[model samples]
Target: MTSDSRTLQIPEHQQDGAAQKSCYQKLSDEHVEELELYRKNGLHPVHLGDVLNNRYEVLHKLGHGTSATVWLCFDTQTSAWKAIKIIGASHSSDDRPELKFQLQLSRSDLVALPTDHFWLVGPNGRHVCLVMPPLGPSVSSKHQTMDLEALREVSMQAADGLAYMHRKGICHGDFRTGNLLFRLDSARINDLSKGDMLALIGEVTKIVVETDFGEEPGSISPRYLVHSLNTDIFADFITCQIAVIGLSLAFEITKPPKTSSVDLPYASPQLLLRLPPSTHSDVWALGCTLLEMQTGSVFGTAPFEIMQSMELLLGPLPKPLQRTWSRVYPEEMLHPEGNTEYLTWRSDVISEIKKHTRNADCLLKELAMSRKQSLKGLLAADDKNKPGSIVWQVPEKQVTQIGDLIKQTLSYDLHTRHTADAVVQHVWFDQARIHRKPRV
Candidate 1:
């Protein structure tokens, strides 16, 4: 077949939602010539078992989104399995302002973002097909739930990946459970047995040793030695940290909090309001995703519902929120003092969850303890703020400093937020021996 080129119409706004859906819809009406080019260049139609790019032999369809269809494929050359996500673009697109702009921007800046982070895996080419690691079935596919420690390990890796991206001034735009993958046995470095329901329950639960809270200060904890053995997180941390050394990107000012339901509960408040996401956004999503992993839920709310809910519960915005919002969202009309109210609402929600749900309550207790220890260093630093109040719950002798850093990484404000690189320098990462050179 001869090379054919065509462009299909894609709405400007929809480009950021889902790439798979965008590709399929954009290509559905494209000219025959463009279709010919796709077939000739290796990105054939969404047919089962058809090989694309002569390298990836489609084995089965994995999942599909607006812009693309992901297929489980085998590499003819490597004799290894891979994920191929086809984002079909045409040569004759008449309209697609948002998509065009994003594509143009991605093309210019995308390469700048380091792709070597193992946890941040994706395809190597951009012509149309997005390559990725071969993913096992969903977490639920193996068992109803995973070990909390395993999930934490996975999250730590994801954090490393996000830190790398943030350092490079890149935002994932969409961060969700669906985007993560569990490596297969053949892909694993060690001969460790594959996970199953039994493994989920039987795997040793990791205990924390190094205390972030000052309450545990001067305490020697053996549990701190149980940091994750997951390789992806380490690789991501190393590579991303190197790549994101210097890049300036626009960051949004948080507006005052109006009492609205979370639009994308998993997305950071900044990103939810269309602000440029930063390391803090990644931390926020990580926190939300951790909640999702515990509860098995996705996060979102319709605009109308959000507004109605916020108005009913919050009553009215506080002054500080109004000032913050005015600076963040000048064009959008928002409740004058919404940000402060929103934070209160958030605290209330967490408190309510702790009171109501056993699982959430337990987690909140653990996290709260962790949070207290995280600020241990600053506790004495701000004795003026502490007056007579005790800064920590656990005795200072037993507290771990790592707990404190983790808490700050998840701080609410964007400006006061610590960079991912900064987080890696914490005692936890250091004690984990993540960056230490192996003895020759």
Candidate 2:
């Protein structure tokens, strides 16, 4: 079917030139999916109250990505909350390697697998709909002021999840904070009545899609676009059980993926160098993820910039890779001018490193202050009266252990990188007190 067949038909008033073009309300792209994408092989138009397969009732939009839109749905038959991911019609269910791998490891608690699957024939086209247990927002979306204990919990859970996947011979080609979702309290969430759930999540914000001549959106787009569900209410119920998600780039160890589309900031040197993806590359990405979680920022924004940061932080690139880097990015491009006095690249690299280091230091300082305050409260002593407080200093042993672990995973040589299993068993993770209690 042609894209035109799926698009909303222009109103007769506009066709006859009776209505003014300027009368229509133009919708902002913010907080909503692109209206232009609702076509023949694009996103399936899903409304809040719509029911799919005569069972799952769409409650709110959980999130969306380039290829699919995830909705928080209530399954009438099972009376359970589910996150239904509706893949774009352009992608075929049978051809998706993600589906194959997820099905293989469906029983894994560390990974978010589809509990059920079905096809939805919409105005756009037939799309693959995956039913999964609803999960909270990604770790990357969490507040930067997250406590050290919570951070440790996230780190340990993520490492454990990755280790599980690696043990199953699956390589999560794109391993990053964005792909790690915090597990919600299923029993608590499921037990909530529809009205109670709505009250907790707050009202859904929606905007009417206005077109030229005030044309109805028709079947192409949703009648009203819904803002993604606010999951802040579930923050207290968020568990340490993190699940590794987004398996579209995942591949098996025996059959390496021919093509990879990892985000540049999280991508390993092997991937950036155009080498085939392997489990080693996943480890490199994991290192970057752990560092991001600890520091509240990525190492760099661009590929060349990240490579430069990698060199400074993880030591110089391997000899062969250094030669390849020179070939890829010539000296003239990196240095620009022969004069060392105005070396912007070097200055920029130094600035970036200092910025991240300062962020890490700030987090460490916060942790130390928290510890000091806790001790003061426990001892019930004033700062001036306490002689032991003068000499008391928070130990940096955990910092050193975590640094060693990250260094091992972010090793220059892929062979020298820590395996996923080793990362989980690291000394740093031992400090993580695994508990489901609410964050203080």
lDDT, candidate 2, equals 0.72
Per lDDT, the best of the predicted structures is 2
**Residues 1-440 of candidate 2: C-alpha lDDT, one tens digit per residue:** 00112233344343223242333333454556765556667789998789999999998888877688999988999889999999999974755655787656766677888877899999778999988988987887762435666777788778877888888888888899989988888988899888877777776677665445567655666666677776666877787677889988777888997767988898787777777888898998888898776655566776566776676565456668766665666655554364342222355644655555423344445545544565456356554643232214435776666667777888878777999999988877776744534432
lDDT of 1 by residue, 1-440 (tens): 11123223333332223322324232342211122122222232443346676666654455543344556566677766566655534311212222222332343221222111111112212334556554444332221234433444454555565555555444444444544445444444122222321232232222222222322212111111111122222221122111111111222223212322222655554554555554466566655554455334433463223333333322323445434544654432334444434332345643653354323234345554544543454455665732232333433322334235434554446676666566655554443345343211
**RMSD in angstroms between candidate 2 and the native structure over all alpha carbons:** 8.7
Model 2 error, position 237 (Å) = 3.0
